[model samples]
Target: MSVNRATMQGAFDLCELFQMGGVPSIIAGGAARDIYFGVRPKDIDVIICGISMETASEILAGAGIASTPFHIYNGAASDRLVGGFKLVGTDIDVCLYDCTDVSEAIDAFDFNLNQFVISGIHHGIDGAHVRFVGEIHWSTLAAVRKDFTPARHDKMQAKWLDLSWRRATGEAVEVPVGGLDGPY
Candidate 1:
């Protein structure tokens, strides 16, 4: 994907905000990838290693940021895995870090670019720090920069899945809260 300025600025601003808490945040999932390519992510997934959900919730509560358990999961209904929190209106989902380190976490994603971590992001998580898999496909990535192509269409379908997920979970889709909320 072709990097752009606005998205880069957004990543820096987000890092600035995260650093305010004085905690190391692992930017995971597709959000990391989007930030790498200078694409403003629809939602942000952050992971912290040393904090419990209760502690994290308390911190956010003290900061006036409403947070609740992130209900989205990929496994069976009976399985309770990876407790996380979703900050209301901010599109931020904070997950409790597991044994999987940032390196392994990034590799679990569907795409190469989605695999990354900007370690020790202080008051400034610059775009230059965005890491990725050793390999990259310029042509496929470039297609993401273009508008209304198959990639975009495929993304739209993926957005539909999110909408379905929300509906199934009794959650409402909102641009501020994170759903399909862009050109898609």
Candidate 2:
């Protein structure tokens, strides 16, 4: 789909929502990459930190979003899959996690945001401005060792390996994180 201003705005709105009340959330999955590239995302993945999975669900529910049951399959904490309203048809995946999980992810992941080059300036509701920072997720996962299915891992590895080869050949490289492997 063609990227547009509204797409970026939705992401900004979600970011604001989390910052104003959600607290300690990291934009992950598609939203993170899309925002970084000045595009709107089909889904917004908000990884919540600092609250119990149940408490996070309650908070999300109060905001008119419904929480999905916690599952061991997704490798996400507790997720809230939301849609409709002004964000109709868009998926808002809220992954609620504890503070310790967030900290550990930051500490262990080699591709974590803590190790990336982030620019402060970004597009927002008011055009180009310095409103948010681009966070990298791979390092965080590498640190935390959040596993995925092997098939998924293989697919992701193939992509990364391609990029790495390109980089070796003097081309720009974009890193990837999600894939199969782990307990998921």
How high is each candidate's TM-score? 0.50, 0.51
Q: Per-residue error at 80 for model 2, in Å?
A: 16
Candidate 1's C-alpha runs over 4 A off are: 1-24, 71-81, 107-113, 123-128, 133-184
After aligning candidate 2 to the native by TM-score, how far in Å is the CA of 84 from where it should be?
18
Supply candidate 2's per-residue lDDT for 128. 30
RMSD of model 1 against the true structure: 12.3
**TM-score winner among the candidates?**
2
Q: Provide the overall lDDT of each model, using Cα atoms, as 2-decimal numbers.
A: 0.47, 0.41
Q: What are the RMSDs of all candidates, in order?
A: 12.3, 9.4
Whole-model lDDT, model 1: 0.47
